[model samples]
Target: MSPIRTIVLTLLALLAFAANSVLCRLALNAEQVNPADFTSIRLLSAAFILAIIIVIKDKSAIRHINQHGSYAGALFLFVYAAGFSYAYISLSTATGALILFAAVQFTMLFKGWLAGNKMGNQEYIGLLLSLLGFIYFVFPELEKPSIVGCLLMILAGIAWGMYSLNGAKSTKPLYDTASNFIRLTPIAIIGLIATYFYFGLHISYKGLLYTTASGALASGVGYTLWYQVLPKLKPSIAAVSQLSVPIWAALGGVLLVEEPIELHLAISAAIILGGILLVILAKNKH
Candidate 1:
């Protein structure tokens, strides 16, 4: 692919991911679908679609699951997918994405520290700014943030960070991506079953459709695009690109669901995005 095509495709992939958040929020907040059910169906649908694609295009990808490093990937996937979906039942999409991404950033920072990478003053400042922004954004909704919900989002973010870092260490990115989903989908299915009995919620047609699109298009296809472009883009560029996700998701909420875009939300988003950019840019400079 040409340079322009790669960049365009990468942008499209990010858009798809942002749409995933929007779709999930729509299914839950508008359609009254259980978040757990939405998540499970999404994962299962994506797994099925990917299975078909792999079988047709690359049967060898399945063998990679038996390799030495596949388990960690699968574990991360299960934790992230389940927690992320469940959290959205109580949390706003914008708030959830901000918190989750914040956790991911911190995880990366700590990982760097553990690896003996020097942390600069600017990075510390950026972290503080971002954290303050996050607090501000979520403060209005704190009355009933649901302890379980917050914890689940945090855990999901950590799981995703671990998944990204681990995938970086793997020799076969495609195989790792595919195998992780295959392993993770069953766990997601189990959770859906448990949630049904525990919460006494039924799956609706709207939920199934939303989840399936999320799983197949966003999780499977979007991720494949991410893996393809990750090696090509600079880390700083990638980070900046992800900053667009929350903005896109917020806009999506406003447009699709008529969610209010409060002044504080805009302010908080500016702060978080500015801080994240500063940190990423500073790291790249060195």
Candidate 2:
């Protein structure tokens, strides 16, 4: 893909991530669906949509769904999903986001180091600038996270980090992501059973509407786009780039969710975006 196309797709994927948070909040806060059912339907809908997309892309893809993805990727995906759903129940968005973001970057950076990759001084500066900006952006809203909630969010971050690492190695991102989603079938079933026994199934058309959009657009397509970008990016770059997620999320929240925009958000955004640019452009010196 051309550089412009890659940038556009990356931005779109970020937007999808932001939209997901808004959508989930809308549905759950309205009591339209419980967390368990929401997680189940989100994965289920994404899987179905991705499967259709794959079939349309290539009729032969039917037999290829399980060809590209590994069990490890699927397990990581499940862990991320489960941890995210549960963590948000007890943790404030700022607190959860801070922990999750830090953990993801650290996990990916650690993995990159283990893989024999090295970062330049400029890259280190960029990473620190971006992280600091992200922390500042969310600082005012952050609350003390509960022990369990903090731990869950951290696990979610690690799971996502591993999933991204796996995707970075895929030759066929679309196929691999679709397969990962398809592989979630058993995990989704387990979630359904656990939720059924604990809270029962709560269904609503409105809730389904939100979940479906979240799955098909924000998740299925979004993740595929992200996977496509991963191969072109270093793990550190990819992780730092994700600091922009909350900036976009805050923007979307203001425009779509009617949340007020704060001055610090814009200030931090410049720092984060600038830091990302440096990270992307500065050559690795090691």
Candidate 3:
């Protein structure tokens, strides 16, 4: 791929990832769709789009779906999706994005450490800085995000991180991801059924529209673009590039939802991103 095309695709994919935060906030905050419905529809749409792409790309790949996926992977995906939607009920787009991404990075790094990958001093310092920054960001304050919301988003991030860790071993990432989404169907259905009994299904046309766009455009197509560009980029570059996701999400909140970025958020985001960048650079250093 041309350098220019690669940059454009990378930005597009990042933007798509960021959009999920904004879209979920928009849908849930506005009460257009309940969280349960949003998660179910979003997962279904993403799975459908991804499956179609796989078939179009290679018909034989369809057969691998059953072989590539696991119930555990599907559970992680479901938890992430469901927790993400519910968390957005009380979280601003920027704040939620920040927490989610930070948790994901730290989870991956911490897991690597537990797996016997030794970390340098710089990596440890960076990890500590990021963790402290996260704690300070969510600590009780006048304008702090809801404790419940923060915890749910953290859970969502951890689940997503686990999902990514599993994917790291996959030779066919796209197929594996597609299979995971497909496998999540039964879990989502059960959640929706329980939701109906408890919260009662409440969905609007606009809600359905937003979830579909989120799943199809942002998630399905977005992940496709990311996978296409991932192999061409160096590992460090790919890792650091994701740091922009929260920033883009913050920008999206301002532009798309009129969400304000407060001073606390700015400071915390800087610390978190800076620390994460440090970790990535340290890991890639010779």
TM-score of every model versus the real structure:
0.89, 0.80, 0.89
* Per-residue lDDT of model 3, residues 1-286, tens digit only: 7999999998998899899998897788765688888898888899999999899999998986888757787888888888898898888999999989888888887887898989889988898888888877887542655888888999999997887666555666677778878898776678779989999987887778888888888877776677667667775676687788899999999998999999999999988888888889898994
Note the Cα lDDT for every prediction shown: 0.76, 0.75, 0.83
Model 2 per-residue lDDT tens digits across residues 122-210: 87897789778867755664565456776787899899888888888988888888888889987787888998898888778887898
User: Which has the better TM-score: candidate 1, or candidate 2?
Assistant: 1
- The alpha-carbon deviation from the true structure for residue 246 of candidate 3, after best TM-score superposition, in angstroms, is 0.7
How many backbone clashes does every candidate have?
0, 0, 0
For model 1, name the residue pairs that clash.
Answer: none
In terms of lDDT, which candidate is strongest? Answer: 3
How displaced is residue 140 in candidate 3, in Å? 2.4
Order candidates by lDDT, high to low. 3, 1, 2
Predicted candidate 1 versus true structure: per-residue lDDT over 61-122, tens digit per residue: 66655553377777887788778888888877776776677667667767877999886899
Model 3 bad stretches (over 4 Å): 1-8, 58-64, 141-145, 227-234
Of candidate 1, the 10-residue stretch with the lowest lDDT total is 167-176
